[model samples]
Target chain A: MEVVKKYSETELVQLLQQRSGNVFSYLYDNYSGALYSVILNVVNEEELANDVLQEVFVKIWKQIDSYDSSKGRLFTWMLNIARNASIDMVRSKGFQNSRQNRELSEDVYSAGGTSETKTDQIGLRKVVYSLKEEYRVLVELSYFQGYTQDEIAKMLNIPLGTVKTRLRTALIQLREIIKP
Target chain B: MDIKAYIESGVIESYVLGMAESQEAAELEQLSRQYPEIKQAIDEFEAALEKQSLAAAIAPPAGVKEALFSSLESEFKKDRSQGQVASINWGRYLAAASVILLVVSSALNIYFYNQFKSTSTAYQSLLAEKNTLIAENQNTQTKVLDLYNSMQMMSDPTVIKISMTGIAGKENNLATVFWDSKSKDVYLLPNKLPDAGANKQYQLWAIVDGKPVDAGVMGTCAGLCKMKNIPNASMFAITLEKKGGSATPTMDQMYVAGKVG
Candidate 1:
């Protein structure tokens, strides 16, 4: 069992800015699992998610100086990076072509129960999946896939006002379910 | 303004999710600063999102962490090498420019001498001035080359940089030691130290198994001075000593000391 050291947010940020390798290791240990899950959620392919995860960490290391604590927590900032990188990987031309082909052969791949079952095994992922179908899809698209409410509205053929309301409701419900 | 309504409007949620437009996000950030309750609401939502994300957490494959660290290490090395390349290019450019200037000046000297034999004294002064400029440029080039070499040595991956800071009374004194583990070579940079004057000099010591071994005596140098190598050592210290140096370190005269990691 490894004894993990704890640092306050301010201390962590200071050490990170100083390029302390120890702090970076501590950061990776504490947050990689959460960040990896976020990337996996967006990309949906384990191999691609692994690549995006590495890219996200590299981005975080390079751009840590740009991180502003006043805007949000460190993890929230990292979560956004993870999601955006994953989304970028999925949105690339090559990825889209491959994904289209994969979808065509989805029946064969589904038999293996890869990404869906893996996500379902997690406790909170199940809770998130249990959201009302409308709310769940909205949460998945906007939160995991880095889509805006307007974009979600356009994509889902719903009104912009309705998108905002549904997303708000969906998040509020998630908050309620996950509240300890 | 209705802060409660603003908080309840889910704008904070939008911002946390990174779904908010730039203008909306900026406004919320400003509002969060102004209102404690709005900040609290944003914090609560961010906490919820963090919890949700963590709940879905999956440990990456076993070798990923090692891969990430190695990539980072290589990235750093790449950056350093790029910097060295840039500096080397600049040095070559400067040298080329100086050589061009020297050649052009020599051509002018010959052209002026051939055009006016009666103005021979003026030509002699011009020749002297050109020679002085050439010498100055050569001196500068030598200094630049030395500085570049010192930088290259200091930035070597095998070199462990140790900053030895001043002891209690000599708090302003500072120096650095770059010890190459593979070659067992030591280089010292005297960053700040009181002048030892004529009779006394600074001596470096490497502590091995609780005893001090003399590394070398300091020479007055602007750049890194090569010191004697110690195959095994735990700490390094510098002390004021007799000009030629002493077999034993003068403990009370210790200026700066730093422990090896």
Candidate 2:
């Protein structure tokens, strides 16, 4: 049971900029769970998700110097990296060829089921599952699946304007549901 | 710009969720700086998303972390090796330098420890000497204060100074008694008296109407020694008696006597 030292956001960024390995370890220990969940949701396979998570951290370490605090928060930046890496793995030629038979909807359903079983400890699966079907689908596509608003609009056969508003409404609803 | 309309347009949400086009995101970033409300809206959404993501976290398989760290370490090693061809030579030089440094530091440690030990010993002795000097100073101050008080008492108009000269064969023995008639307090100064040997003490006696009343025994003091108070005494005298003082004065051993003038 090693004691983990806590750092404020500013201090963490400063240490990270100084290229401290210990701060990187702290970052991984604290945020890896959430990053893994997002990665798993996108890749939908444990082995591939693991590889994506590793790649995401490596990218985070390498790109830390370029991180702009004014643009967004550290967690948000890392989340973006994780989501991008997971999406890249899923859209790769080998991954799509292997799972070509499975429908994208079935992939989403299986991803949801996998997340439900894996994240039972936190019980946040219920929160996402509890969303209205339309809002939940929009959130899963735009957020977890890393689909562009335009792509989601085309895929769901909805107007681009409708996709944008519904995605916003879904997030607002999520904010309300999770508000303390 | 209509800030409320811009907010309701869902641009801030799209920006936070990373779904906005690059052009749209760039525009939002610029506008957020100009408008605080837009910034607040973006921040609120980002916080909400972060909280939800955290609540939805799943621990990765155990060996993943170990494998990831080892790979990172190996990558670091590969980079170092690739960058430095003469690293082996540098490693040998570093090892030799560190060995010398260790020996030098150990020697310095022993030297410093010895120096500290002797310094502390000297400091302790000096501290003890200072305490002894302080005690001696206090003793001297007390003697000086006693002398000053005695001088003050003698200068008072109501105090009569009685000089008791040695009686008969003990003529060299002399003492003085300062008697304050207003307060009837008696103080004695054994000016030139022989030390009373073991098992004996010098005692003072005050005579009232020709009857000698025992005063008190006199202890050796550097300054005036206070004796028993006598309201009316015609004479004061000192005599050598038993260590605790006799009830009646030994008229034969009367060393000094003086009439109160």
Top of the candidates by DockQ: 1
For every model in order, the fraction of real contacts preserved is 0.54, 0.49
Candidate 2 lDDT (Cα, 0 to 1): 0.82
The collision pairs in model 2 are: none
lDDT of 1 by residue, B198-249 (tens): 8999999999999999999998664898899889899999999999899999
Q: Model 1 residue B135 lDDT?
A: 100
Candidate 1 yields a Cα-based lDDT of 0.82
- What are the lDDT figures for the candidates, one per model? 0.82, 0.82
Compose the digit string of candidate 2's lDDT tens values, residues A29-146: 8888888987876676788889999999899878988888898888889988987888789788898886665676764455445333454234233566678888878877777667
Docking class of 1: acceptable
Q: Which stretches of candidate 2 lie over 4 Å from their true place?
A: A1-5, A108-126, B74-261
Model 1 clashing residue pairs (backbone): none
* Lowest summed lDDT window (length 10), candidate 2 chain B: B74-83
